[model samples]
Target: MTCPPPTATLRPGQLRDPFRLLMDVTARHDGLVRLGRGPLGVYIVSHPDYIRRILVTHSGNYIKGPLMKPFRTALGNGLVTSEGELWKRQRRLMQPAFHVRQLQLMESVIVAAVDRAVDRWAAAAETGRPVDFLDDCIELNVEIVLGALFSTSIDPARAQRLRELTSEVFAGLASKVWTFFLPSWFPLPGVIRYRRAVAALDAEVHALIAERRAAESTPEDLLGLLLDTVDAETGAHMSDQQLRDEIFTLFMSGYETTATGLTWAAYELARHPEIAAKLAAELDGATARPRPTFAELRSLEYGKRVIDEVLRLHPPFPIWFRSTVAADDLGPYHLPANAKIVLNPHMTHRDPAYWSDPETFDPDRFTVGRFGTEQRHAYYPFGKGSRMCIGERMSQTITQVALSAFTGTFEFSVAPGFEVVPQYVVTCQPKGGLPLILRRR
Candidate 1:
């Protein structure tokens, strides 16, 4: 005997601070609540038992659903948007790209990007100009992802153009998140902008793919690795369209989630200068001048905790969405077929039941004895279950090696009087980009 959940009514303007509003509702309702009206209503779930049930226990009965419909519109049927056999095949084909060997290769790319960032930061420090942490991270992740994918094969200007085109595409797609509830026939400005951006993006990506195919060389870069990979059962390479889908997905995932994550980490690091100082000392002691190799950087145990704490405070993918394939029971609540669902890591991470001083910035929470079973369930910035992010290892490595190298090179603190607000877009980026001042340590 289950019951219909309580509705958490929120006015349109409350979307301005959805993090707080949603958190309030979820906690007040005992971690299960409803939002919006009929047909467009979403059931928000934050409890660990319920989260694991939906994401792991009954994952087979869930599909990408309405939330990812817009992603499909933007990304074709990439792993993030695909379902059934197509998803399984694509996931298998792409798995090797994030293998241990590949992550080793990415470490160098991450370090190189950090070095380039350090050079720019040194200039900013000398001039005493505050840098927008979000903007800087966006640029940094773009460089790192491209470097890993194409390496020296891409020209700087060409990479910059890709960055520009990607931003256009992201902006257009973001505008559609809300407008998508409207009928497709409606000629909204967002849809128009989205189509135009998609056209330009497709042209650029397809042109690159065609060029790579025509070339006689098959290098060991990510693109080459992807090109070389074949379906084990079919022994067939991914079609050009599939490649485009995967590549586009990678750029979106690689750029938005990581860059936003680094921004939030920078915010907390800047806010707590004492913590930042300790991190700098730990990172400084971890590696040598110029750059920290992946192996040496990973040796810093404290650095790992800082990264975890950053993500715990600000999970990039704050909301995970799914829909029921059939009628199902989520804890004590009954969800009908096709019911929209949201598994909120943001609320779960900050739940007072799981975290003491949930609002406090604390890395020690993840220490040896502390981060046990409950904590694991409460923290999933990369998601959980079989559908968890494929690039999880590489993303962590990028955060680890890049943060260590950059912090080791220079000390950074948030500029005074600048309020850091986690602006929810494709991911959680600082609203208007948080400002931080780099100093010569």
Candidate 2:
């Protein structure tokens, strides 16, 4: 049997920057490239066909892989981290909450959250203070997610505290993914901090759950849906622990990913005033009121393309992993049982073979009627197949609404000499935050 393409061993310095290292390896090898040695073997799949095979066609041959293990402490068996029948059950129970029709019900709630942020940003713009654009996105997204889930707004102080803690916890989890050899049970300072952060986040989620249970009425929000959902097969409802885990998982997965997407949209728009102007024009023409309704959001074609391009350029979850359940042949390579595979959308989306002018920030690449068949699997920001993000529709709606509100009301320019570096923590975030000057339009 033909051996897989030779593994690209990492140099010591390359280990420090895995994203760059992976990019270099993908550029050097063909569609399939193996890395590392022994039981730690990794196959980095870059081609869309192989990606489709692994994530979709042959999905049952793999599972969530080892990379997601560390996140279990914080995420529990919630949809994002869980596997097997449990994942299916939770996904089914929570699926309706993200349906387009269901999300439309929360349109006013989303608008209210965005309005609150716009009010704050207007004040900042008036003062001529440079706002951390990414931080602002985070706050707005956190508020939006919480309000959507609970149908109530959280205290600003408490929301800020939860944001910091969740960031710490996820950063710790990302570090653990990179340093797989380090024992999480080692009780290092970072590990201790991660535990504390998880505990704090859990406390907040549990408190919300408790308050909801004791209240006289619960709105038909996500939390209420999860609490009310009963399994068709077993006729069982989620327990309090299950509810807490799912709620926290949904909050973390939904908020951070959406915020990251919006942040990158803002970053890209600020960098390209021409594109920003187009988006602003589309937003202005799409609505006469302060906020667009759900139908109006669908009409903002240019705005949607801008967001699609932003997600293509900077996917929040840049890397995904899956492990082989048994020895099998993949393309020209023969893989042994339990071999790890890495799917890098970051590399695939930028592959020159699929995207013209891959390095350029051109939203027109996503313009309707311009994309080709190959682009289907070439751009998977929210992933593909059965395990695709259940929150994809809601995220898109949240991002479209938030971006329209902010870009329509204000003009944003990056702070002079501010360099944007992509930091791959749990999510790819703009390093040092995105500082921008906002002027009310």
Query: Model 1 reaches what TM-score against the true structure?
Result: 0.96
**Per-residue lDDT of model 2, residues 321-423, tens digit only:** 7888987777777777887788888889988889999989998888657687888769898888999888888889989988888888899998888899988
For candidate 1, give the lDDT of residue 37: 71
The C-alpha stretches of model 2 lying farther than 4 A from their native spots are: 153-161, 181-188
Which regions of candidate 1 deviate over 4 angstroms? 15-21
Candidate 1, lDDT over the whole model? 0.81
Q: Clash pairs of candidate 1?
A: none
Give the TM-score (vs. native) of candidate 2. 0.94
Which digits, one per residue and each the tens of the lDDT, describe model 1 over residues 292-411? 677776577887888889888888788877888999887778888887887788888988888889899999899989888878878888888989999888888888766766677667
Please give the distance, in angstroms, between residue 133's alpha carbon in candidate 2 and its true position after superposition.
0.3
